[model samples]
Target: MPAGRLVLRRAAMLFAALALVAVGVADGTGSAVTTKPFLPDAKFDYQIGGGYPPASGVRVVSRDVKDVPAGLGYDICYVNGFQTQPDENGADGQPLEGTSTWFAADASRKQLLLPNPTPEYPTSTENQRYSTPYYVDPGWPDEIIVDLRTRANRTTLAAIVGKQIQACADKKFDAVEVDNLDSFTRAYATLADRTSAREGTEPEEGAPTLMSKNDALAFAALLIAKAHSLGLAIAQKNTAELEGEGKAAGFDLAVVEECGATTECADYAEVWGGNWVDIEYTASGFSKACTSVKSTISVVRRDQDVTKQGSTGYVYAEC
Candidate 1:
């Protein structure tokens, strides 16, 4: 070959080798991680309060994944992955029985932390106090025991939520809402003390329970991965602390309760961008959220009781 042709041939061969190397690196990175597509600036209504269809003009509705459609816009299924739903009877009926307990600060006992209290609200300090009207069901328990911080707890919850995920797929919903993401910081004062008490105990017996904070993140990541694999969007329900960790945990959307009322909407805006949906319980809260994020995320107001439609009292408003 002429000198010029020989030089051209060598250059083409070098380029081919570089392309192969690039492909190899791309393949390696692809196997390491996968991300979900985010659906920001969407509309939604949390109507698990009423089993009925969403009112006119509502674009999305959240319901127990097990239940059929309520004839709403897009379906955003509900799953109590972080906490258990109470049985029909009452607190005495049967606890959601999460796998982990508070592990009192002393590490001597396992206790359940109560859901984070809304503004000016506190979870029941005692079980007796929990039995009161304000502490009643439909809203949330003043407190309950959980094992969510353990490997076993993570596995169990993953399995339970896996079933719920399957339900979402079977029902053909667009997304899944995992409630109680902020329970860790909600009633931490009281429950944190319990976990301290229960530390350094004998190896816990019984089924698996709550994973450690690290474990919880791992579990959340797994759920996010699985949901994404199935083409269902996974939401981070009310956990602002987790917002920084949201992308790492694999959450695609957010379902915030009272963010505007508590001045927490900005955080959601930062994390989920326009993909958040804030559910306010008061008119003031609704106004605040609408004024701020309506141009981005969806906003709505519902009765504190989350009452059913056509009932004596049911409140639903959108921004």
Candidate 2:
């Protein structure tokens, strides 16, 4: 072979050798880990608020991380990853649960928590340990967005949240549904800023730091990686616009909210195929979703609050 052809051949051989190296979840335990995915297009139910016995044929159930596994199906533990999960009220000394009990309330963790951009804001302490008055997400005033603006902050928050995600794995949950991945979509400088957001666009970050869609995806990638490391499949929750980036980040599936109501279930279906789960809150939306999306992925209609069976206003339908 000519010198040039020989050099090209060697380069191609090197590239092929590199590609042959397996790309898989790195287990900190010194073994390669693999996540088990949920059955595609399985009968699904959302029990984020509370868990109950599945309504007959239900095969997949997602519930809040505070709850234990329902022990009946492919259980997914719901975790609020980008922001502090609203853990109703608990004093610091008394010990709270979830993120509120985690780093959010720590005054020193203000660096990890985003600054309250819009306020009757406090110049003083609000979360003696974890209240949103410090840097609460206005849309959900009780919740606070974590700082993902820097690598250091993301790393620190990942370590903190990863522990809780590991709990889901420990509880024998097969997967994790991480909510609030779109905090980057809304700029929460004030009450009005909350209403202003273009889908797929991260609101502009002003002074004290507001996250963008890119920031949200980056942080989500961390949690997804962590979940996989623990041998648990993780979900890309509700940010339809980020499905491509999310799949690239190794998310095993998606847990979508109101995709049916918004007439956007197809957006997720195109990407995740049968691995996505669609949730609807209205009858008309459910009907439409069943007609259009049910054949491709899981779809359900539940009460707006996602209450359990026998509760007043509880609604559960499957397609």
Query: Best-fitting candidate, measured by TM-score?
Result: 2
- Cα lDDT listed for each candidate: 0.55, 0.68
Model 2: lDDT of residue 147: 75
Q: TM-score of every model?
A: 0.66, 0.79
Mind giving the per-residue lDDT tens digits that candidate 1 earns over 1-319?
A: 0000000112334433532331111111244332223334445667765567676766677877657665544577787665555433325553333322212221322323222333234333333333221221222443343445556656655766677777787888767877655444322333333233223222222212233346456667767766766667777777665656775566666778887777777777765555567888878878988988787767888887677788777888887
What are the runs in model 2 whose C-alpha is more than 4 Å off? 1-31, 88-93, 97-104, 118-135, 188-192, 195-209
The regions of model 1 sitting more than 4 angstroms off are 1-42, 70-73, 89-139, 142-145, 187-215
TM-score of 1: 0.66
- Give a tens-digit lDDT track for model 2, residues 282-304: 88878987897776677888888
